[model samples]
Target: MASSDLTRKPTIRDVAAVAGLSHGTVSRVINGGHWVSPEARAAVEEAIRTTGYTTNHAARSLATGRSGSLAFLLTESQQLLFSDPTFALLLRGATAALAERAMTLVLLIADSPGEQANVERYVRAGHVDGVLLVSSHASDSLLASLVAAQVPTVCSGIPRAGDTPVPSVSIDEVGSARMMTRYLMDRGHRRIALITGPNDTPGGRFRLVGFREELGDRFDPGLVEQGPYERDSGNAAMTRLLERAPDIDAVFAASDVMAVGAIDALRR
Candidate 1:
């Protein structure tokens, strides 16, 4: 064979020929080695290594009716999305998980109603196999649209309290908040104040519930402050709490950014 011909990109047929097996066997091995014998699998792997064959994911997706892609949708304003480390971590984790399964992750930021509508259309168009929803608000309309369209979805936090039932993965926000509050109380911090996230969010509401539950009689409505889950909001809330109760010893900010802001407020 000519050098030019030999230098061509190796295909599944080439691997099959080199392994002394049919293309079907090679395909089966590449897909998952489900029905292939151990000997055949080994031979195919060796042939793939020698031939440098790479699967064409686009072609496979087309043939299988699967996009081999997932959407990591965030329903928050651009400023909040860019400023929050939580969103960054969520993107990183989702990307790594999708890569492990040989799939791609598409990021969609839908903060406004118009953006949400566009995202809903794009997702409903069969572009991605599923969606990993993050930072969803209780009043966000995207969740209901996605559910109505029947697109497979998994939320980072529990969806609304009684809305569409979307599967999710999240820590027990209430329990964690309770634990933190209890620890503060144990440490002799009586006038413990809270800088809560927006009440429209599940995390925000649950954390407040847990804090109040843990504090019991000690829960002072006077020390409670509510704000957006932003640095400025945290700073403002912290300032208000200090003004309301100068004797406050400790503060629990709902998020890391909020905590930073709270610390800044204390310094001032």
Candidate 2:
């Protein structure tokens, strides 16, 4: 690029000029069009790299009537969102995926009704193309609202089956819990305790079911403690489990953060 153009951000026009092609051809190449010949695509890509041109997403979004963004909606408290490392990993993965498509990710935490209303309004305003629901509770009205707005959404975990056809991805929570419970038993830990997520969440509800089913006749209700998927809740639950069953030999916490807390309880 010339020194004269250094003061301003390079645009698609600059790339087109450098590529010796019309701006429309450059646009098609940038948008991943199959119509472009190999030579034309190569020229545009080379020009883009040479001129250091980046897309003006805002302008493109306005022209296409798409915001070029997706929401990472977490229907959980801000405390839980930040304290849980899993959310961080999920956010990072989502960000990377969106970056490849020249899209942006917006984060919205709505643990309260008012916050949910705000998120609903933002989504309804066409500020986002879709929502990537990172966490949700069975009773959260946000899911219904998203459905009513006719917004596309993909959930991180299996949400309660509802009329809204929102797609979701999840692990085998029940089998995972059952395997861990059995693992502890195999190690000859008879007095094992369980720390579980809240009943409103899929992980909280299904994992406990597996843990209970795996133990069968050996399960002890006195050793089970419910947690909110955070370290403090895990710590408190572990402490309570130990208080109720002083001879507790092992613990299976539903969340990693909770497991850390259980270890802290053991240290204490």
Candidate 3:
């Protein structure tokens, strides 16, 4: 193929010719499909870099059943995820797992209902091999959409009780919440308060359930509060909890970012 025919991006064929290898050999190297001689792989890599070659995902998908690409769906803003330590940790873990599989990650930003519909459309279009969703709310329409798609999907955090099962890998949220709450109980805190994430989110609901399970029903009901999984929201929630229950001796904020805000409120 002529180089002029190349549009905005170079393809594996370009790299293959430059590397003096067959297109199949170049593809094998690119996909990590099989082991190639070091010299041959080196030549392909050099050519790839020189030509600025990228994979033709559509063609590859047609030839092979697998796309070798993973989609990560985020229902939050980049700013929120970057600032939240919990999201960062999850990102690190997901990145490591995908790297181990030699897969490429395509991040989909779906913070709103409209954006979520777009995600569904893309998935239905066979744009990716699999999907990983990190939802902030339980009973979300997006989760329902994903479940209906019947794609091999993995939920990054706890999932709400939904219609279908989506394979998931998550920290033992309820157990962790119990551990955190028990710590406060051990510290001679009687009237403790909790600032939980939204009740509709799996992480939020599970953590809140764990907290309540550990604290029991004897504590004043006013001490419990709900807020967004964010710093400012945590601060405001903590303030509200204090206003309602001034005797609250200890506070448990759902996320570390929220914890920071709770601590700030206490200090002030």
Question: Taking the tens digit of each residue's C-alpha lDDT, what string does model 1 give over 1-268?
Answer: 2367587888899899899999999999988748889999999999999888898988887877778899999888788877899989889988998889878999999988899999999999888998999878877878888989999999998788777888999889999999999999999889999888888888899999999999998898998888887899888988888887899999988898899889999999
Local error of candidate 1 at residue 251 (angstroms): 0.9
The TM-scores, one per candidate, come to 0.91, 0.90, 0.79
lDDT of 2: 0.89
Off by over 4 Å in 1: 1-4
lDDT of 2 by residue, 1-268 (tens): 6889889999999999999999999999887667898999999999999999987777877777788889999988999877889999999999999999978899998888999999899999999999998778888888878888889988899877664767899999999999999999999999888899999889999998999999999998888898689898888998888777898878888899999898898899
lDDT, residue 120, model 1: 94
lDDT of each model, Cα atoms only?
Answer: 0.89, 0.89, 0.80
For candidate 3, report its TM-score: 0.79
Q: In order, how many clashes per candidate?
A: 0, 0, 2
User: How displaced is residue 116 in candidate 3, in Å?
Assistant: 0.6
What's the C-alpha lDDT at position 70 in model 2?
A: 93
RMSDs, each prediction?
A: 2.0, 2.2, 3.9
